[model samples]
Target: MELTWLELFIIVLASFRLTRLLVYDQITQFIRSPFFDEVEEEDEFGQKETYLVPKNRGIRGFFGQLLSCHWCTGVWCAIFICALFFVYYSIAFPLLLVLAVAGLASIIEVIVQKWLED
Candidate 1:
């Protein structure tokens, strides 16, 4: 089926938002490592950064790796969202629409904050 520009945009935005939520939000905290801690990291620019990461353990470390990388989780999220959109087009569109709006707003918020910082 053909998608309108807005619909396409919504799909992209929803995928992005869902990926971030699953990877970073407190709602999925249970799946994250409880013992993980944030440590100071330095970038190429020498700017100090911090990130909370779990220690890697082979075989059992799949979930930790999955939840940490947006590219990995985003692929799954996009597939699920797209399947839901196709299977329940009429029922899911409104919810997807709302998520798209929220996602766009959040992205704009981030860009604005970055601009203001500079």
Candidate 2:
């Protein structure tokens, strides 16, 4: 479907939020997995740290895989974004815009860091 500038902007913002939430949000906390383990991990800024991560198992491991992948999350997020827009565009519009901008800033930060490193 053809989208106006505003709709396109909303989709961009909402997509950012969707990608971020499914990958980094607290929703993953509620999922218990047999392969869950915590290990030392370095922060993006180069600080040493640790975090819990889940290992992919058999075919049943799809949920874990989905939760761990931002791209995969993005697809689901896109679907939700559209649904939210259709259901309540007024409220969803600003909310997604704010969250999506935050997500975009994060991406820019990483890109800038990589550029500096290179």
Candidate 3:
């Protein structure tokens, strides 16, 4: 099946947003809390950042590693979204639209924040 440019754009945006939601968003912390531990680390500049360390072995560790890395999660998210879109376009379109809109809104929000900061 061939994907049109618009469909491709939607899939990419949806994947990106979904990956971010799974890996970085506070709303999904409960899901990650079981597999990973949050560790606070200080940089040379004395800035502290929270990091997720895998807390289990085997399957749980695999999931923990997957959930903690944006690049790894994004690949899976893109594959999952694309496969769903191809197999169930009617059902997936609405979800994809929501994710795409949210992703665009998030990018715009970041841009506006940076503009304001400048």
Candidate 4:
């Protein structure tokens, strides 16, 4: 099945937001908490930041590492979104639409924040 430009754009944004939701959003902390531990570390500038430390050594560790890395998670999210779009467009479209809108909003929010900061 071929996608129009708009559908491709939606898939990209939906994947982006889904990846962010899984990897960085506070609301999904519970999902990550099972595989990782939150550890606070001090940077060179003396600023403390929380990081996810994997809590296991085999399959669990693999999954924890996958969930924590944005690029890793994004690739899977893109594949999942694209697969679902191809296999179940009617069911996936509404959810993809929501995620795409959210993704666009998130991009705008970051840009605006940086613009204001400068």
What are the RMSD figures for all models against the true structure? 4.5, 5.8, 2.6, 2.3
Model 3, TM vs. native? 0.87
Which consecutive 10 residues in model 1 have the weakest lDDT in total? 29-38
Query: lDDT per prediction?
Result: 0.82, 0.73, 0.92, 0.94
21-113, model 3: which lDDT tens digit per residue? 999999998988888887999999999999779877988899998987899999999999988999999999999999999999999999999
Candidate 4 lDDT tens digits, 1-118: 7789999999999999999999999999888888898799999999999977987788778889899799999999999999999999999999999999999999999999999999
Per-residue error for 6 in candidate 3, Å, reads 0.8
| Residue 56's lDDT in candidate 1 | 69
User: What is the lDDT, from 0 to 100, of the residue 27 in candidate 4?
Assistant: 99
What tens-digit string does per-residue lDDT give for candidate 1 at 1-118? 8878877788889898888888887887766755355689899999999887755676436666777788999999899889878899999888888878888888899999999999
lDDT measured at residue 66 in model 3 versus the true structure, 0 to 100? 91
Cα lDDT for residue 88, model 4? 95
- TM-score for each prediction? 0.73, 0.62, 0.87, 0.88
- TM-score winner: 4
Inter-residue clash pairs, candidate 2: none
Cα lDDT, model 2, residue 9:
76
Instruction: Provide the lDDT at 10 for model 4.
Output: 97
Query: Per-residue error at 77 for model 2, in Å?
Result: 0.8
Between candidates 3 and 4, which one is better according to TM-score? 4
Sliding window of 10 residues with minimal summed lDDT for model 4? 51-60
Model 2 per-residue lDDT tens digits across residues 1-118: 4669977776877688667665666765555344355679788899989766666577436666776677887888888888887788888878778877877787889899999999
